[model samples]
Target: MTQVLGIVDIVWRGRNIPVEKGAKFRLGGIKNTAVTYGRKVGRAQEFQGSEVMATTELEAGQRWGNTWDPGEGELQVVCDTGQTFVMYDAFLEGDIPEITGGEGGKIELKWAASAPEEIGV
Candidate 1:
């Protein structure tokens, strides 16, 4: 079955955190830093790709529970089209809920590379 990338379900640990239809997620993006290189005329900077990670923003109603904490676990990002990516030793960041008026809060999740060796130069 073909999985749709536009819509996906975020499974933390084992439970599914319901998300809004327009929920945004950045899956497996390039993480990199710039380095100065010596050039004949001048110095140039370049962006080198680093470890891959995932970032997501979820609506208030989609929040998992009352507490927002980073636990040692795996985050399963499954797309409706059937594609799935398992983030190993995953942890959450920017999980604070922002309240605006009577609307549900919005929480952001940043899944970083767990292993230090993978990110080592």
Candidate 2:
């Protein structure tokens, strides 16, 4: 079964933004590796550590302007399933949409791992 997890809220810079529908959160991990000469085969790889990235999108006009500062701040994402993710060294990405067609605006939050535990999540 495919379980759908919805984002409940996002707290950033001491302000909260209640996420509406169509919110998305993504996390990624990458290893620090390098290709080297192998003994038997052609080449091999050596990996040292991992890097992590966390990102999410939220609806604008709901405390986004007050909380978002480019290249600064941290964010905490709470989901409906009791899962929480802390995004450190966060920064704001993408432009806040402005239109008169009654369409909603969205802001994208991007962050990297700042702690040991956050490097793989």
**What is the per-residue lDDT of model 1 for residues 19-114, given as tens digits with 9 covering 90 to 100?**
556544454443544455575344344433212223334454554453256665666667666666676676665445454444444344545543
The lDDT leader among the candidates is 1
Lowest summed lDDT window (length 10), candidate 2: 112-121
Using all chains and alpha carbons, the TM-scores for the candidates as numbered come to: 0.52, 0.51
How would you encode candidate 2's per-residue C-alpha lDDT over 5-112 as one tens digit per residue? 754566665676655465555553444444456644343444332122233344444444574556656666666666666766555654543333334443334333
Show the colliding residue pairs in model 2: none
State, as a TM-score between 0 and 1, how close model 1 is to the true structure.
Answer: 0.52
Model 2 deviation from native, Cα RMSD in Å? 5.9
**Highest-scoring model, TM-score:** 1
Off by over 4 Å in 2: 1-4, 31-64, 96-101, 104-121
Give stretches of model 1 more than 4 Å off: 1-4, 27-67, 114-121
